[model samples]
Target: MKKNINITEEDRKIAAFAALAIVIHVLESSFPSPFPGIKPGLANIITLLVLFRYGWRFAAWVSLLRVTAGSLLLGTFMSPTFFLSLSGALASLLAMLLLWSSIRPWVGMAGISILASISHVMAQLLVAWWLFIPHRGILALTPILIATGIFFGLFNAIIASSIEKRLTDTV
Candidate 1:
């Protein structure tokens, strides 16, 4: 009974994290961008936090929920944009998981952020090429997207690091 209770609590935590991620995603999207797809990716902060706190499985679940819920709410639904966002989030989460498990101890947060950013951009590019622009014309956005992803990744890393520090100290 105690074990089952603990499992329920864990499930609740995952759901709560995913809800927060979705909220962040929506709020970030509300911020006006001069160009499309230049989102701040504020929800990614959640992913980083989950990676440090719970590991890859939880982080991946949060990422998946955030993208799906965010897309549904944002009216993208099953559109190309939704798929692109999903792909990017998955790639970023996977990269964070890999780094946290293997390279993060040696390379640190900055390296993780850079790698995750690159993975996100690449994932979006691949999705775009496969889904929307088979002619590969969306490749033009790669450079700028990569730069933006890196900047946002660094921002998320800072936020995650600070939060982790605060939580650790309090606990």
Candidate 2:
């Protein structure tokens, strides 16, 4: 049975953005990190830009697609690493949704990005502790994870904002 599936312009836009994010994700994954779970998460800049430009829904599509497709490309699909990434992405999306719905008028990009980053780290930590580690030591990484999250969150937001500005200027 052949059925025609209509694809909208919006879907194409989402796929293009998702592809860019996935490339960044793969490149970031190739880099060596001082800590096991620490990365710059440069791919998130795409999500942030999409969120501010389009909306939370578009951003969520980009983020989730990046995580899933990136994992497949990295051969980590269905692995512990995949689960961690999925959990972090889901948590970040949830945080973005909440902020977008509530205090979006008051919050700026940095604030939203920081909160999302912190939530992502926390979710990954909890999932690690619950599913794999099951040790108190995993929780000990909380402070450092949070610190990096804030730093990277702010960093990504700045980059996103710059990109957004350039995009607006061109358009």
TM-score, per-candidate, Cα-based: 0.87, 0.97
Single out the weakest 10-residue window by summed lDDT for candidate 1. 1-10
Q: Model 1: how far is 169 from its true place, Å?
A: 7.4
In Å, residue 147's CA in model 1 sits off its true spot by 1.6
Candidates' RMSD to native? 3.2, 1.2
Candidate 2 lDDT, tens digit per residue, 89-157? 999999999999999999989999999999999999999999999999989999999999999999999
The local distance difference test score of model 2 is 0.95
Alpha carbon deviation, residue 26, candidate 2 (Å): 0.3
Q: Highest TM-score: which candidate?
A: 2
Using alpha carbons, what is the TM-score of model 2? 0.97
**Per-residue lDDT value at 108 in model 2:** 83
Query: Whole-model Cα lDDT per candidate?
Result: 0.82, 0.95
Pairs with backbone N, CA or C atoms under 3 Å apart (clashes), candidate 1: none
